[model samples]
Target: MFEELRIPTLWITKVRGENTVEPTRLAPLMQYIVDKTDKDTAVIIEGIEYLILENGFETVFKFLTNLKDNLLAKMRC
Candidate 1:
């Protein structure tokens, strides 16, 4: 649905439930989505380090960054 719906979405897979995704796997997934689309996406994340990522997420928030960067670059120069 996400590939065509154009809305940002996430699919959760369980560990020991046929497939297991590490909680840490989420980081690169988030980065990949950002790189692929411009829309804001929310993930229903549950992890031990979840609370610690609030500030860190922003540092890697480059999804649709070209749009942001382009606009900022124009405004600055």
Candidate 2:
């Protein structure tokens, strides 16, 4: 569906998952968004449930908190 909109997208997945071009490491994923996104950027993150399942709620919460902080700062610009 996203592809139909012609927007550039990145897909992350676990090491054993198929059809995934990128690894699902939290840091790298956040870094990629930080590097690519701006105040006007709209992002679609599709796999929070999967992330929590794989890495637990606490870890995912921290990751999301950091990512939110970063994006919020950017939005202030």
Candidate 3:
């Protein structure tokens, strides 16, 4: 699906392989993208249940909250 849309995708997984990001590292990765991209960016997260299973609801919630805050901060600039 991402290939058809021509959108680059990164896998959030514990598996050690190419184009894979661990759940713990997702926040920093997203922050980097938000910081570097000049154009509007659309982020589609598909595996909330999986992330919750791996990192609990609170952790995922904090991650999302931080991402939202970062995006908003960027927008204000």
Candidate 4:
């Protein structure tokens, strides 16, 4: 569906291997996106269930909390 629309996209995965980001690296990756995003930017985070299964809910929760904090901080500025 996304491919047919010609919108640029990235698929982050651990299994099936190509174009994958390590599960452990999600936080830093999100931080990078937050740092680089412009006013028109949009981000889609897929696979939360998978991430939680891979990294544990506690770690995923912390990552999301930090990411939210960072975004909120940026928004305030």
Candidate 5:
């Protein structure tokens, strides 16, 4: 979907394939992208229900909160 829209995306999955990030390692992957990209970059996280089903609500929530905080901090800098 994103490809057809011309939006580049990094796929996060547990399939252990090339260029794919495992769901458990989402934080580091997201942090890496956040660090590398400019402030104008917009991260669209789909499949929240899937993530929650795989990792539980608390874990996903904390991950999202941390990501948001990190992005906000980066923007402030």
Candidate 6:
């Protein structure tokens, strides 16, 4: 899954089980998040706000830019 798609930082929902989401890593949009998972502390990443909370590097206005850049980079191959 990581080697297939092109979206970086594949959001993982640890509520249900391990690796519940697909496309683990876009492999193009700068796949980040080395140690996001916290067994002791869980963070729910959802809605538009979650994007900012989880990925503070992106701002509301800059979100589109980041999204486009990442997506484009992932599909470049």
How far in Å is the alpha carbon of 69 misplaced in model 6? 1.4
> Which TM-score value belongs to model 3?
0.75
Sort the candidates on lDDT, descending order.
5, 2, 3, 4, 1, 6
Per-residue lDDT value at 19 in model 5 = 61
What lDDT, from 0 to 1, does candidate 3 have?
0.76
Q: Write down the TM-score of every candidate.
A: 0.28, 0.75, 0.75, 0.68, 0.78, 0.29
* Residue 51 Cα positional deviation in candidate 4, in Å, after optimal superposition: 0.7
Candidate 2 positional error at 20, Å: 5.0
Give the runs in model 1 whose Cα sits over 4 Å from its true position: 1-4, 15-21, 39-77
Clashing pairs in 2: none
* Tens digits of per-residue lDDT for model 6, 1-77: 63475333344443544344422222222234323322232223345454445556445336446655654554554
Specify the poorest-scoring 10-residue window by lDDT in model 2. 15-24
Number of clashes recorded per candidate: 1, 0, 0, 0, 0, 1
Among the numbered candidates, top TM-score falls to: 5
In model 2, the runs with Cα more than 4 Å from the true position are 1-6, 15-24
Model 3, residue 31: displacement in angstroms?
3.1
- Give per-model CA RMSD: 7.8, 3.1, 2.3, 3.0, 2.3, 12.0
Number of residue pairs clashing in candidate 3, backbone atoms closer than 3 angstroms, sequence gap of 3 or more or interchain: 0
Candidate 4 regions off by >4 Å? Answer: 1-8, 15-20
Q: Write the per-residue lDDT of candidate 3 for residues 1-77, one digit (tens) a residue.
A: 77897767778888978767887786666766576454477777888998888889998888888878887787778
Best of the candidates, lDDT: 5
In order, the Cα lDDT scores of the candidates are 0.44, 0.77, 0.76, 0.72, 0.78, 0.41
TM-score of 4: 0.68
Clashing pairs in 4: none
Expressed as tens digits, the lDDT of each residue in 1-77 for candidate 2 is 76797665767664544334343478978887887787778878887888888778998899899999999988887
The predicted structure with the larger lDDT, 1 or 2, is 2
